[model samples]
Each structure stands twice: as structure tokens, then as C-alpha cells.
Target: MATNVKVIAGDPSQGRTKSSPFEHPYALIPTPSLPTDGSKPHGALLNAVEMFLVHNILIRAINSILYHAPLVKLHDDIKDFLHFCEVFVDFTNLHHDSEEEHIFPEWARACGQPDIMNENVAEHTTFHAGLQELRNYAKQTRDDTTRHSSEEVIRIIDSFAPALTTHLRNEIPTVLQMQQYPNGDEQRKIFAKGVEKGAAQADNTTQIPFALGCHDAGFEGGKHRFPSLPWFVIMGVVWWYGGTHKATWRFCLAICIVGQRRRSFEIVVSEHTRR
Candidate 1:
């Protein structure tokens, strides 16, 4: 698991050639976020945040299948799972990106500690890289027109799941703390950004990357596929990522933006119920 990383001591961007320690077994990133005094997270936000990550990577895993399905080399069942990615991952990515860009800054500014922005940005960058690597690997296989086994997909999953999961475990707690926020300002920013982003999310410019459109045509542009298995699994995954898991993503948006609070209602229901 990734330690609670308040600050990273080492430099990655420096040097003639840029590289990450993710490939190395012994690369150590520090967790200055840990206090000298013992304390524990009540996990008010931790559980939901973790589910958000689960949905994200799992859907991307499915999207990898969708992106490669048309090619002769890919397996059919895997391709079937991609529809989940098409509908879920792109939506959530936009949501998370909006959060990072709009929500986090507001929290940092409100809490009067804008310094945490750098760490969150770095973590976001790392997550995108892991995503690109998986997509690239799948794309190369698609081009080969060579048959792929479940084993190959699992290999890709194995490579990505650890890093992505570690990121979820570590980075989540850092942001969810009450100390990092000032009232509900950050939540307000999230809704404003979500409405703005969500409105445009249906456009070709938004979903084309994960699904079919001008940019992805040769690789995966065609009629939309609807598989209930994928959609249902993806809904669960969505709950895992930024879906129904987070009280804030659901309730705060409702509370801060919609001004809906029945008994100071924080999400009336969460993934716990789904489980």
C-alpha cells in the first residue's frame, strides 16, 4: 500500500531522461503526511474514495477490451466488457478531472494551505501515465491482429492494479481530512465544475476518446454497443470510482449546489447498501 504521502522528497522530473520509480522494486517515496503524534483516520471519506478508484481502473480494464474488440486478435467476452468502460470510465474521468482542477483548488484555498496542490497534481499525473501505459499495451496488441488470451489481459491488469490501488489508498486520505477543507466551498466548486463539464460531456469531443468517434474511428469507431453485463458491472465500478461511493460526490453536490439538506443530509445512501 502507498503510505500517506503528504510530501515527496525525491525529484522525478530532473535529469536528461525522465523516468518513474514505479518500475523499480526499491524506489521509495516518502510519507511526510504522517504525524509524529499518533492519529487514525475515522475513514469518513476513505471508503468512498477507494470505491471510486476501483470503478475507474476496472472500467478502463473493460475499455481496453472494447478498444481492441473489433480486431481479430482480441477475445469476445473481453470486448463485451468494454461497453462498461465506454459508458462509465470517460464520464468518471471527466468528473475526477473536474474535481482535481476545480474542487481541490477550492479546498486548498479555503483551508489556507494551497501548498497541497502540487502533491495532488503529481498524483493525478502518475495516474494518467498508468492509464496511458495500459492503453498503449492494448493498442499494440490490437495492431498485431494476433489472438490474445485472458492471460495477456490479466498481465496488463496485474501491472496496473497495484500502482493504481496503492495510489487510491494513499492519496485519498490526504484530501478527505477535515483539516484540508474550509466549510463547503470546495464542494460548491465541484458542483459548478461538474455542471459545466457534465453539460459538455455528452458531446463527441468528450466521449470519443473512450468510445467511438472521429478520433478513434479506425481503432474503435462504430455503433454503440449495449451489453447489460458490462453496464451492470460498470455501474458497480462507477460506484467504486466516483460513482455512488463518495458522500461528497453525491451529497455535497446536492447540498452545496442544490441546497438540499434533509437533516443535514449527507448522502442518504452509499455503496455500503449496494454491497
Candidate 2:
């Protein structure tokens, strides 16, 4: 895989045109003012923040392809960008699936709010369809050597941009609102468990690397805490499984060691660059 990346680095296009979406600038959700000490029912907040981060990354990737369509001539660049798309889709799908199977159901049962997460659940269909379309387009682009224009991919993304953005933006506040449940104590416990279970369910190989690649540890003065994972697995198991792909995630930093009664986990992250 590493060798293939460099082999196709040479491709030429002398006079192609550059074009990007000109309508309006896209805005990402501001990272919420979440508590640092874990006093709050912040499982939802952490999960929502992860979603927001991935959403922003995916949108930016799409925009980058379209924005530099003219300048990007190498097959390797296109392939790498498309690989990023696959990772994005995989992460999004894994997250939503985990929520539907574990997180949402637990939240509903614990909070006695059966319909609280229904809207977010329903919104998945709208974006999932678009995601599938974009994924399919990316696959096609990957397979076809003659293919150059990203206009179709751009159009497909634009077709669902409104609904996708709405779902991404709206769901954060909805999850954040779960902190206000009447049975607050039980709800916090449930959310924490749900987050842990959801993380465990994800494919350790792609899931861990993709997440580490996208997450910015420096954000908010390096004080922001991300959901923690086990030290043994991250350092031992994950490192072995990741293999060649590990180089792509050199940005990861082992920030902290989370010790609980039942288990202990280390936080893998990126270096915090003080701005």
C-alpha cells in the first residue's frame, strides 16, 4: 500500500480549469463549551463532538477536491482523497450503527424518553443515502483511470448538503439536551456505558486510525478531553494490527491514562500545538 502511493505520484495536466462551490461559505459547528472534569453527563457531548469533527472533515475533503480540481493531476492525490472518503464513510456508518444498536436505545430507556433520539435516528436515512451515493461515486472514480472531473461527486454532495448539514448541526444540541433529563443520575451512567460500548464495537484497525487522524488534540488549549480507550489495546493490540497504516497516524499522541474500577485505558491523540 505504501509503495503504491508513491508509484502513482506522477501524472500530468497542463491546462485544466479550477472551480469550487461559489454560493456561500460552509460553517462548521463550534466545539461546544463542554465541562472538563467529567462532572456532567458528557458522554453525549463527547460523542456529538466526534460527529461534528468528522462532519467538518468530510465537508472540507469534498470542498478541497472540488476547489483544486484543476490543479490536482496525480492519480495518487485522487486516490488518497478517495481513500479519505472511504474512511469517513466507515466512521460515520459505524458511529450511527452503534448509536442505533446501543447508545440511543439505552438513553431512551434510562431517561424514559423513547422519542428523544427518534429525530436523530430518522435523520440518518437522509444522510446515509447521500453518503452511499458519494461513496459509490468515489469508488467509480477510483476504478476509472481516465476519470478526472469531480463535478459529479460535487453535485451529488451538493444535492444532499442541506439535509446532511441540518442533521449534523441539529443532532448535537439534541444530544446535549439529554443532560437535562429528569432522572439525571441514571442518565449519566447510562450514557457513559453507551459511549464505552459504542467505541468497543467499532473495527479497531480502521476505526482507531481514522479517528486519531481526524481528531485535533490541540484544540481548546489541549485541555479538551476526548473519550478514552484502553492502554493495552492501543499500544499493544492496535499497533500490531495497524501495521503499514500506522505511519499515517503518527500524529497520534498518548495523552492520558484513564483508570476505572473495572478497566483502564490510554488516550491516543495528536500533539497539542499551542496557538
Candidate 3:
């Protein structure tokens, strides 16, 4: 409704108008209540990105452990998983701060009139509260290396990753449209401004590394076009451990390579060579 932008959240019929009758979802975890005085903050995408990163890293770490399994050797990888978790949690808290400080305020200003966006900000605030609850529980389990990451914490993270993923997927289209303008010059001006702002703030920083770690490589059955990372990191990850580790390495490699259309030409060449 702001120019050509669409707002899709909340209940859908209380005198629905360009002013907005589309109710926004409770959308976001329970978090600290946000102020409604209309100060444009930051974050939103970063929060979603953090969720994506955590999801990928945690799930991959869990799965990687299974690859080294028979229990005994899993001990070492499990230690790695815990260390990773510590770092992952630290990243998430910082990301959340960006949301509370900057991103939500922007949403509030961007959607001030219908204030659906403002309400969305409120929802984001609640999300922080939920995270705080998680933090308390997590702190209690700090020295513990087991899966004591509360079912609530795990459940929220598990649910949030997919939900946040969906939100980001949906929001990106909106961000593009919001940046577009009446003409090329106008569009470029707006984008230039956005780029300037982004350079200073750069919320996506932690996300890029976390996302790359989670997505680009795997043992078996996943998308392969994600790009190979540095060889040393790959070798260190795949080889330093042992045979079971090698299986996981080969498994990831096989899916990446063999999944490539299963070339009929390879079979043909092999048969010709045999003859």
C-alpha cells in the first residue's frame, strides 16, 4: 500500500483498505515489548539470516556427528559441535541486538500509517523476549556439553529457521520493490542510498559465513551448486579425523559429483575402453 508495495500479514477483514485490514501474523518469537514512539530502528533481515545460519550449522553439525558414529568417535565431533554451538549462540545474540536497535525502527517508520509494520515491530520485540527466555536457559546449561539446549530453545530454533526462511524469501521481493522507483535514475538513487546505509551497518556479515558453512558442503543428498570453499578447510574437515570421516567426505563428494545428470557419455566411454 506504500506506493506499489504489498503488506501481507494480520487478520484479513476489519474494513480492509489501502490503510490495511490484512492482519500481520503474531509473527516472531516472544520478545521484549518494543516502544511505539516511532523511532526507525534496524534489523529484521539480519534476524532471519541468523536463524538460517543457526539452522544450517546446527542441523549439519548434528548430521555430521551421525556420520562419525558408533558412539566412541562421535565424542570428538560432539566436542566440536559444542564449541561451534558456543560461537553460534554468540553470533545470534549480536544479530538480535541489531534488530532491537535498528531494523525494527525502520519497519516502524516504513509502515507507520497503517501501522501494520509498526505492529510487526511489536511482534519483533516479543521475539526478543522469547530469545531472552532461551538465553536464561542456555546460560544455565553453559558448562554442560550434552543436548541440554532446552527443548524450547531447540524447538524455537528449529521452528524459527524455517519460519524465518519463509519470511526472508517473502521479504526479499518486498525489499526489491521498495527500492524500485518511477524511472531508472530514481531507482538508482534509492538503491545508492540503501547501499550507503548498508555499508555502514552491514547486518549480513555474520550471516554470510554461517550460511556458507551450513550450506555449501555436505556428506550426501543436497544441492551442489553452492560453491566449493577453500581446499585446506575442506581437507582439514574431511581428512584430519579418520576413515569414518572419509566416508562422510566421499559421501558429500559423490552427491556433489554423481548427482550431476549421471552422464551417459561416461558409461559409453567406459564400455568402449573395455572393448
Candidate 4:
């Protein structure tokens, strides 16, 4: 299947002194467009809204690592970089877990088709080992510090990124297919409830802030407010929680605060070196 992928380019005005070699003009996975027509199936549209918002964050996080990995100094910068990778792994796992545990089962039951989500579950197996390897590498490197290798990090991601991204992109259309089921309004409610439950189960202290850090609010002309939280939560709560690992969060392509404007994609090595 043809997939639309576009590389995220860093704006020169965002504080970078020179163009990053990893900033390809057009090679990253593009977020699937949500439907606007009122006549469209509401269930599919709602599913698209939820899936696209989270999927875009996942795509950006992956691209951020790909764009910045080569710039990291293995010995001096590996600590924070590995933490960032670990956060990525955690967030990705949480999303898939939510789907498998909450969203997929609910949707299948609602549709009266136990196998509706089987393909997605199978796709998870394709990248599960690679993701686990990444998590293990990050933890091991943090303990030893000497085993860190930027190339090895990138190599692990490369092994699974294609399959991982393909699953991310394809699942959008599969969810959209829920439009064909009867009782559209009821299905939408079911989806919303599943989404809410899944979100409530997350470890807000880490996963929430990690997701905020991954999101670029200015994406696609800045029309959406994702993971939409109250102003106080974003400014007061998320800001406080995100500070727990201040240095590690810096590798994120965007800030974790509300209105997450673009920041330079370069990972700072000097700060870690100083410590």
C-alpha cells in the first residue's frame, strides 16, 4: 500500500546555527488527514481524530531521534539520549497496550467481530522484539555508560522503524473502517469511552509529560490542540512533572508546555558533559 510520509524539517529561525544533516526536506511519515464533511460517518471520524493525534506524536518522536542521533557524542551525550529513547519506548508501548487491552477489545465487541483487530495485534508482534531490544539497550547503557553507541541506537531503530511506522499508518484506515458498522452514534460513544479509559490508565508523571514533549503543536498549520488539557494542567502540572528529568527532555523536538512551538532538533552534549 502507498503511504504518505514527509520528513520534518527544522526551521532555521528556531535557533539552530546550521542545517542539521538529519533534517530531510520530505521523508517522514505524514499524519493521516481527518475528515471534515458533516455527512461522513461520525464513528470513523472520531476514531481518526483519536488515532491521528497520537500517531502524529509517535511519528515525530521517531523522526526526532533519527534527526538528532548522529549529532550525539556517544560517551558524553549517551546518558540523556538513552533516557529519551527509553521514554519513546515507554510511550510507544503504552499506546499499543491501550489499543490491545482497552480499545481493540471494546471495538471488536461493539462490532460483534472478535477478529476485527487481529491484524493490528499481529502487526504488534512484528516490532515487539525490536522495541524491547531498544528498551533493554537504553537501560543497560545507563547502567554501564561505556556500552553506549549512537550507531547501535540508530541500528536498532532502523531494524523496526519501517514495520513500526507501517503499522501506525495502516491502522488509521482500519479504524476508519468502523464506519461500516450499524448504530454509528453508539459506536462513537464506545470508542470515546475506550479512549478515555485507556488514557486514565497511563502513568501521568512520566508518560503524559513524555507525550507532551514529543508533540509539535505547530504541525500541519497548527489547527489542532491534542491531548487537550486545561491551561492549569499544561502550565502548572505538566510543567512541574516534566522537570523531573529536565536534561533528558531537552532532546525532544518540541517543548513540553502548552503551545509546544518548534525547538531546535540538536541534542545538547555540553550540558551533560559539564555534569
Candidate 5:
């Protein structure tokens, strides 16, 4: 896949610049992006914050199929379930690789606490092997063209779910707390750099749309967290390159958030609170 970079605007509102004397060493950095009026959960953690929620939604999708697909007696349902697994695995690898290689380092640098994210990085090792095995299984299921054991696949996925979910849940607060970095503009710059790096590594056909599909832009009474390009441009890219490869996205909660409304390829969110 050829590399492409997408530019998105940062939140216009500025946050508090002062550091309190009583504040902890890693005080949360004030940001205009984080909700102040308490209208919604702020998305200003985990480097690419929105991606954090999107990751949870993906894990939920994978877990749902693992638990429920076994009860499905029909062969077609089993097939569809396996297909969803493939999408989940691919999307996860793409996301994780980006985090490990690009995003985490930025957060660590901004925090001046390189060791702060060490545990999160270590947690990735625990599930790395399981993720690889699951991906291999997904591929084998696709290529074998035979009736595969849904029970076995579910067990494989279930084995990894606990660890994966732990990392996902634990990360929310870890990242939310990173707001103590004391420089919102610098933090925003780091975020943009990470997004650009991830975009360059992405496959426009599969990964781009898959990432878009994972985003729940409707969070907090229908608002997005990033800037957007023209609707036609985004739609054009997805339609032209994404092709007929997005079967599993419909099952994602992010897409369901908008109900029957047309999906946006552009990523957008408001950093302001709903006062």
C-alpha cells in the first residue's frame, strides 16, 4: 500500500499553563481538548486518545464473536465470525505496531518520565504471541475452504481476551493522567506526528477504512476529536481503494453509533465541553 498523510486541526481553545506547587510530579497537563464542564469522558490520554476507545471497541467486537459465535449452529454464521476475526487481528496488529513504534515514545518524551509507560509496553509482550497465533489461525480458516471448528477458534480467542482487555482498560487512566505533561501545544504536535507516522504505514484499501470504521465519532452527543477533510475526498479514497473488503466493519459498535446515517471517512472531534 502506498503511503499517504492526512492533516487534521488541533483544538483551538487553550488550556491552563500554570503548574501548581502541590501538584504531583506527573500532573495532568491542562488541555482545551479535555472536557472541562464534565459533559463527557475526555479523550486526551494514550497519545492518540481517540484510538484508545477505538481499540476497546475492536476488542469488544472480537470478544463478542468469540463468546457468541460458538452458540451459532449455522455454518454461515461460523464463516462470518471467522471473517470478523481476520479483520480484528489485522486491525490490532496495525494499531499496536504504531503504538509501540511511534506513539508511546512520544508520550514518554513529553512526560520526561520514560519509565512511566514501561508497564504498558511490557504488557504488550504478554499478548504478542497470542495475537500472532490468532492471526495465523484466522488465515488458515480463510484458506482451508473447509468446515473449521468454531469451538476451537473461540477457545483460542477467549484465551487472549483477558490479557488484551486488561491492557486496554488499564491504559485509559494511564493515558488520561498523561495530561500532566504541562504543554498542550507540544502534546498536540506529538499526536499529529504519531498520526502521520501511522498513516504512512497504513494500507489505504484495508487499514484506512478499517480504522475509520473503528472510530465512534458520535461520542458525547455526536462530536468528533480530530479535524476532517472534505467528505467527498475521504469517501473517494475509501470507495476507490477500500473496495469490497469491509464486511466486518458493520458489526463494529462505532459504526452502529450513527445508526443508519452515512459513515464519515474524515475523523473529527470537539475538544470542548458541552456547557
Candidate 6:
């Protein structure tokens, strides 16, 4: 749960490296560290910021897939790619739903600021339509491979990427600002409960594996510890559950069960190709 991690920008121009594929083709949002000193909001609010940062990593991974994956040459790989896109849409929607349903209301009540999170809510709306369109496109393509259009998928992402990324990045500071209130302990409990409720509703089989696949355990010299599942869950449950969509998980930057770093999936048609 180390929170002092800095943002890492994985430039595709650097070519394939020994790093985890999750870290490539985009800039990751950095998680702000909790102050060791007796800071006002040193507890749950900071932890929420950390979790948001983790989600941002996955967000960037989906963007990487859109830009870096060799969709045209993929052929059979397109099936898994479409499935991956579906998983991305599912995870993002669930995260936002959980925030709106469980986290935001509670925070507003506790801080006596009902409209505090309205901006974030509005931001979600800005990207909702485009995200749904991408979801529909991915599902349609999955059902009928002939419908697969990499260009269309990229266009949909382009339409929403600005608003989506803005919301993702802006929410961190808003969470941090909650420290101005003297209810760190209470805010901590609210956030923890929201996370628990969200986790309880997630699809362990697909969403869990998809998240682990995008996470890099060795990030920032292995300082960050995210998705803090036990070894048993990682080795046993994820290993078996991910079997349902093994092909889709293969496109993941890290092994779905274990966060081992590997090269991201990409196709190099010519020596001068850069994506």
C-alpha cells in the first residue's frame, strides 16, 4: 500500500523493454503519499487517493491497448482484444457506480457538503455515452467478428478520453481536500466500507483477473502493494477463475494471477513502425 509512487510514462517509441506491459504506451497517474507527519487527513482519505491511483493504472492500460495492440494484424487475436475491451468497460462502470452509490453520498453527509462531489458526478456523465458506445461496439464485435473496427473503437475512446482522464486525475485532489475536515477516522471508515461494498459486487472471475493483469507488482522498484489479495487468492482463485477467458487475459501486461512483468502485446509490421 505504498502511496508515494510517482507517475511513470511508458513511451511506445522506447520499443519493447523488460518492464511489465501494463506500464507501456501511456503515462500513469501517480498516487500521492500519505504524510508521515501528523497530517489532518492521514488515514482513509489518503487511502482512497491510493486506490484511485490503482484504478488509473488500469485506465491507462485500456488506452494502451487501443493505441499499441496490432488490431489489423491480430486476426484471431481480435477476439481476445474485444473481450479485453468489454472487461475494461465493465470495470470502469462498476468503479464509477460504486463511487456514486456508496462513496459520494456518505462523504457528502459526513463533511456536510452535499454538492462537494457533484463535479465528479457531472464528469462521469460527460464520458458515459461514449463509454457505452464502446461497450456496445465491443460486444457486437465479439458476437460477430465482422463488426470489428479498430478505427471505430479508437474513435470512441478518443471522444471520451479527455473527459475520462480529467475526471480520473481531478478526483485525487478533491479526495485529498477532504482532509480539511476533522473527520479523518470517519472518512477512512466510509471509504473502506465503500470499497468493501464495491468488492462484494464485483465479478471475481473476470474483473478481478482483468485488474490483476493490468497491475505491475514491480512498479516503482516494487514499492507499491495494490490489490492486496493474499497469495492463496492470487495463486488458487485467480489462476482457476481466469481460465474462463484465458485468451483475453493473455493480452494483459502481467500474468493475470501473478503480477510478473512482461512485454505488452504489439505487432511490428516494419522496422520504422512506432505506436
Error of 4 at 16 (Å): 12
1-275 in candidate 5: lDDT tens per residue? 22121213222121111221111221221222555686644235435456554564565456445544544343444454566677777777777777788877877887788887788878888777777787787677766636577777767866786787777766666776766656656666676677788788877655666655544444333445432566566666666665555444433332322222233222222132234
- Backbone clashes in candidate 4 total 3
Each candidate: how many clashes?
A: 5, 3, 24, 3, 11, 0
Ranking of predictions according to TM-score: 4, 6, 5, 2, 1, 3
| Residue 5 lDDT, candidate 3, scale 0-100 | 10
lDDT of 6 by residue, 100-158 (tens): 99999999999999999998888899988988988888788877786677788888888
Considering only N, C-alpha and C atoms within 3 Å, which residue pairs clash in candidate 2? 230-265, 231-266, 253-269
Candidate 4 stretches greater than 4 Å from native: 1-41, 74-76, 257-275
For model 4, what is the alpha-carbon lDDT of residue 46?
Answer: 68
For candidate 6, the per-residue lDDT at 74 reads 42
Please give the range of 10 consecutive residues that has the lowest summed lDDT in model 5. Answer: 14-23
Q: Write the per-residue lDDT of candidate 4 for residues 127-173, one digit (tens) a residue.
A: 98999999999989888777777789889989998899889887877
Considering every candidate listed, which one attains the maximal lDDT? 4
Work out how many backbone clashes candidate 3 has: 24
Each model's TM-score?
Answer: 0.43, 0.67, 0.37, 0.82, 0.68, 0.81
Which segments of model 6 are wrong by more than 4 Å? 1-26, 36-41, 72-75, 257-275
TM-score of the candidate numbered 1? 0.43
**How close to the true structure is residue 243 of candidate 4, measured as C-alpha lDDT?**
65
When summed lDDT is taken over every stretch of 10 residues in candidate 2, the lowest stretch is 260-269
Go through the candidates in order and give each one's C-alpha lDDT: 0.37, 0.55, 0.33, 0.69, 0.55, 0.68
What is the Cα-based lDDT of residue 259 in candidate 2?
20
Of 3 and 6, the candidate ranking higher by lDDT: 6
lDDT of 1 by residue, 1-275 (tens): 22111112122122101121221222222212323367542232432332333333333334333233332222322332333223333544664576576556765666677875566556556556545555555455444434445465556555555655466555555555644444544444453554466446543322322221111101112122221136345344333333222222221101111222112111122111121
Candidate 3 regions with alpha-carbon error over 4 angstroms: 1-83, 86-120, 146-153, 158-163, 183-212, 215-275
